[model samples]
Target: MLHYLLTLAIFFAFFAVEAWGLNLQFGLTGILDFTYITFVAIGAYFAGVAAMTPSTNGGMGGSYIFGWQLPFPLSPVIGGIAAAMLGVVVGIIGLRRLRSDYLAIVTVSVGQIVWMVIGNATPLFNGWDGIVGVPQPYNSVMNLSTNNYEWPFLGISVIVAAIIFWLVRSLTESPYGRILRAIREDENVAAALGKNVFRYRMSAFVIGAFIAGISGALQIEYIGAWNPSGWTTLETFIVWAAMLVGGRGNNRGMLLGAFLVPVLFTEATRWITIPAHPLLMEAIRGMAIGLLMVLAVRFRPQGVIPERKRVFPLTTIPGLKEDVANGHTAQG
Candidate 1:
């Protein structure tokens, strides 16, 4: 039971990472990034390729580049850099030109393109079968049993999650975060006020992509595998659903939604008896999630925890109150 709980904690950590990234992109910046999971896949594959040994001893005969036998800790850093580069390209191409709806479609196409290329191109990252046998960090130093190792890893995951939460929360409260919200609320108004809307949007996109990459790297390290099958476009929506249900603009709400939807609801489905075929059951689950999303949107669009209103001090600006009072007196 303790082991099970530890495993659940690890899952929650990763889910929280994903949700937080999405919240930054869609919730705060309004990117509508349907290709978010593509970054995750890139991160996982990059980390897997980096951490795996070049010799095909445990790789199941799969071949890939950058098998420098690098340490596991460095893999996620490389993965994050790769994902950020991809985000830059995608943001320039899609975010700079297209409106939200068209940009979403283009992003979806990009995700499909990446998935197909990875699945079909056998020379890159082991193609469809994907890379395997990713090594864990510091495993040799501790030399612990597999079951026992998870306990420390769970601690590591919690630490990572907390750090990410703090960083994201801080970002959301900063001046830049206010700009993002302004752009999200009305890009025209932000632009008219001389704010570089595109720049802020791109920044948010790349930042979110970086975080997504880290999350993917952490997850793949724990699972010891990276595959195309794991990163479908639909997976992006799952994160979005969590954001919507929990509260899009609220970080704590996003965390709650992440735990409730991805960790709890998904796991709960496994125990429920379903007489239908496995595919049918999966379809039913998808439908149920869709219905839940619709219900949440209709009834609680602001999310479980609505975004907090930012309050500015009236005394911050000199003479502002006197000018307001003078105008009121003139009107009287």
Candidate 2:
């Protein structure tokens, strides 16, 4: 039971990281970037394959590619870099042409292609098996001797989450974040004003992807394995749901939504007693998520904790765009 509890904590930390990444892209930038999970999968696969021992990584007996047995601590770095590289490549193509909805479709297709390739490619990713036995971060440092390594896991998870939050918070509040908002509001206007809209958008996209990759890498470490099912397109929707319910443009709301919606709902499943049809719980949960999203959009669009708008008192600096907390409001 303690193990389960510890695992649940790790799960909370995991979604929190994922939500942070998503909040940067969709919440702040309004890019939709539905293919977000592909970057995560990239990180997980790279981290997994890199960490796997030669004996179990690939091949029937002992065959591994660049088998370094690198410590788990380094996996996130490797995974994040891999994910960001992949994100850059994708951003070049997709970010070139598309708006909110259309952009989502292209991103979704890209995510599916990644999934299909990873799921089908046997040699590259060991097929469906996915390299297992990936080590947890700092198991050696903690020097604990039991499966109850949950404490250290939780500690590391918190540390990583804090660092990421600090980094993202700094970024979002900086001048770069202002550019993202401008682009989100009116790309044409931004472009008209001699703003390198595409360049800034690409940078935002790549940074968001890197954050998502870090989350994915950390998740693989926590779970001790990285598999094809590690990242799914549907999973992105779940995080989106949390962001919507919590507040699209608010950090507090993002964190609240990440914990309250997905993790809480998953925990709530234990208490739900449905007689006849055991799988009903799953369906019911899905419906609940769908209903929440609809209600959020219709009734509570601002979310539980609405975003606070920044009020500028007639002090318009060069390149400073007007913005309401919610929608894009940049002037050409």
Leading candidate by lDDT: 1
After superposition, candidate 2 runs with Cα above 4 Å error: 55-66, 140-147, 267-278, 311-332
lDDT of 2 by residue, 46-135 (tens): 776666665544445323244456787687888888898988888877788746676677788888888888777766676566666666
Q: Any runs in candidate 1 off by more than 4 Å, and if so which? A: 55-59, 273-276, 312-332
Residue 32 C-alpha lDDT in model 1? 89
Models 1 onward score TM values of 0.90, 0.86
Which residue window of length 10 is worst by lDDT in model 1? 323-332
RMSD of each: 3.4, 5.8
